[model samples]
Target: MEDNIKDSKQLISEIQSQYTRLSKGQKLIAQYILNNYDKVAFMTACKLGETVGVSESTVVRFANTLGYSGYPKLQSALQELIKNKLTTVQRVEMSDDFSDENVILNKVLRSDMDNIRDTLDGIDNEAFQDAVSKILKAKKIHILGVRTSFVVAQYLGFYLGIILDNVHVVRMDMGDAFEQIVRVGEDDVVIAFSFPRYSKKAYQLVKYAKEKGASIISITDSLFAPIASVADNTLLVNNSMASFVDSLVPAMSVANALAVSVGMKEKDDIKDYFDDLERMWEKYGVYE
Candidate 1:
């Protein structure tokens, strides 16, 4: 009974710890979540009830039975669990649930739309603005992302570089990538991009930057993400894994929004920069 709601523990462990206390209906819900947590994480309380052939009230009560304030909190915990822990097998299996069902088109697109909506609705404006302000004032900004996340880092750093004076995109291709960031110090900022099955190397790099006293801005899918754990500012963009392929729609959308926000702040500078570049392009006859 004591220390009942420790969300830090794995969802399965939490459920198992309380298994003896659950009623038959609650146990059914618990078993469903345990077996298919990847699927359950995205379901609404009402939908979850239907999946278990129980009433909506029962699902809510099951959450309480598991020591969550409500279904959303429990759902969030489940989501946090899978984002960084899902194995490749689990991912493909979960993805198969959709294509195998034969409603790939509608279900996949609808799920993407939901992820986009949730990302926008869930973001904190204050955190967004703080990230922008840090980028503007930092003596140098280092953007770190790898694997699937590298593209997002490249997109943000590319656009931000157009407006800002010193934006560096850190890539693993440098081989000695961390060496490129050795000069990170108090006046610097490092924005790290991490998502589902987050890169341990990326997290370690952020931790390194944090140790060097550079302010960290984490762009990730969950507050539980390793980068988020040490970040000075965290921007959450929901990316629910609807298929074997991780959805990048929300992450890309977030990157664009961030670029636009920073662009607005540096509008005059950006204009002048572009103006000069246009002259150079014309001088070279670069256009067809």
Candidate 2:
């Protein structure tokens, strides 16, 4: 229990580090817990085992592998950690009555604002600046995101392309992101966004980009996220402001900051890029 509260990342890393020592059943339980932490936090041993395709005794053994006295104790620690880290409104909305429209609106707004504040406090300035520098200096920038995160990535790619040359946003259903990432090199960078219930494809893209020598910047809910672990630099974003859904306000702000920082860093280059864009717009009659 003490170990679980120390650091979520360290807890998972320790388990992963010793994964080879775990029995087959324990490995199944470990994988389930790691992937469904939020769910396990609220589930009983029976329910957890049912989901993991293991028996209740196997689930208890898995907890013991983590040095817990029993499964209940492990669940308690997970509940406490999640309760402390997740925004209050997230829990409240899950069980509270939202019959009143005004009440719901106020709650959502307040929760989102709190999430933004928490995210700002959690951000590491040096790491953030380093990521920005990587993107700014790269010969090409690739942004990958899926599901809801796709919207944020698209917005970032659009603004970045306006301010920087060689910016590409990978759209959903686009064939083989890994194949696309093969085009990136040591002179390029990849910025990836993924949150809880992370996109496996996004993770693969990050891995492929890294293997190809492209620097990576990840924006995720915690350092425990797969993408965060692989990134050259990571920015933590708090998205648990709502129950079972992640808020995008904080991520959008982070994206905006990255774009503005890169723009300021290459002010002269951006000026020339926009000048060329203006000439093209005039020739194509894009706008009056």
Candidate 3:
């Protein structure tokens, strides 16, 4: 499954290279995808066939020709590619079945459920464990994400700050994100969240940290993501789109898991730390 997902990075080139060998109907399907991928990514096989004036079987054959198991696999590859490329307007216009509010709600929720399931199935356990181990031993830990991903990074940083004293969430608002992590060194661990429409600045930060000898752990959508290449351990999580906005539920789950795992490893100290925190919060009436 991982290999198939990774092949999506080269899917477009593969289609173009095999264009001449495609049948008349397959050629039509191929042309439609090549030209209108953003729209086609969200389309059903039957709908795609109707748009291309080909039988649904032709669409399946086209996918098979391209080495995918079937139409859904082909569509998944297209979705993966367009996640970063599609504009907000394009994303809104891609869905043809949002006529009913109830249907939209159900569809979006189901998509998020699927994203969580797929993420759990595909996430590398060894990499996840390695990330936890690195964080526990680090002299300092840097957390980074920008744009949409910043929410996940912030969630991670907040909880991790509670667990460990040396955690920093790189703040873009403070100044340059680079300056925030300027002190990262060999004993530090940098955990970054980078999803589709990936932040170039995040990549640059991770690369710079790696050069400075920090261990990098990248939590991203694909193995082919820019940060993945530079990461000491890459944790792949599915953040599939059901709307214009990228869903971060799966990423948040991973962040929660990381924080919990780290806390568990230092259970004795964390218990004492939180007890003091609880007393302080109660004295100040921090919560009702």
Which candidate leads in TM-score?
Answer: 3
Q: lDDT tens digits, residues 1-288, model 2?
A: 354334443566766776889989888877887787766776779988887788999988887877788886677556545653555455554433345776877867786998799789878999998998888788999998888899999999999988876899987777866667778898999999987567788888898889889999999877777798789999988775445456898999999999899889889988888898899999999997
How far does residue 238 in candidate 1 sit from its true spot (Å)?
Answer: 1.0
Query: Comparing candidate 2 with candidate 3, which one achieves the higher TM-score?
Result: 3
What CA root-mean-square deviation does each model show from the true structure? 3.7, 9.7, 1.9
Which order, best to worst by TM-score?
A: 3, 1, 2
Candidate 3 residue-wise lDDT at 195: 88
TM-score of 3: 0.93
Q: After superposition, how far is residue 108 of candidate 1 from its true place, in Å?
A: 2.9
Candidate 2 regions exceeding 4 Å error are 1-99, 272-288
Tens-place lDDT per residue, model 3, 76-131, is 88888878887788777866587678799899889889999999999999999999
TM-score of 2: 0.67
Model 3 whole-model lDDT (C-alpha atoms): 0.90
Instruction: List where candidate 3 sits over 4 angstroms from the true fold.
Output: 1-3
Q: Write the per-residue lDDT of candidate 1 for residues 80-170, one digit (tens) a residue.
A: 6666777878677656456556688888889799989988888989999999899888999999898989988998989888888798999
lDDT values of the candidates? Answer: 0.85, 0.80, 0.90
What TM-score would each prediction reach against the true structure? Answer: 0.83, 0.67, 0.93
The backbone clash count of each candidate, in order, is: 0, 0, 0
Task: Output the lDDT of residue 170, model 1.
Answer: 95
Of 1 and 2, which scores higher on lDDT?
A: 1
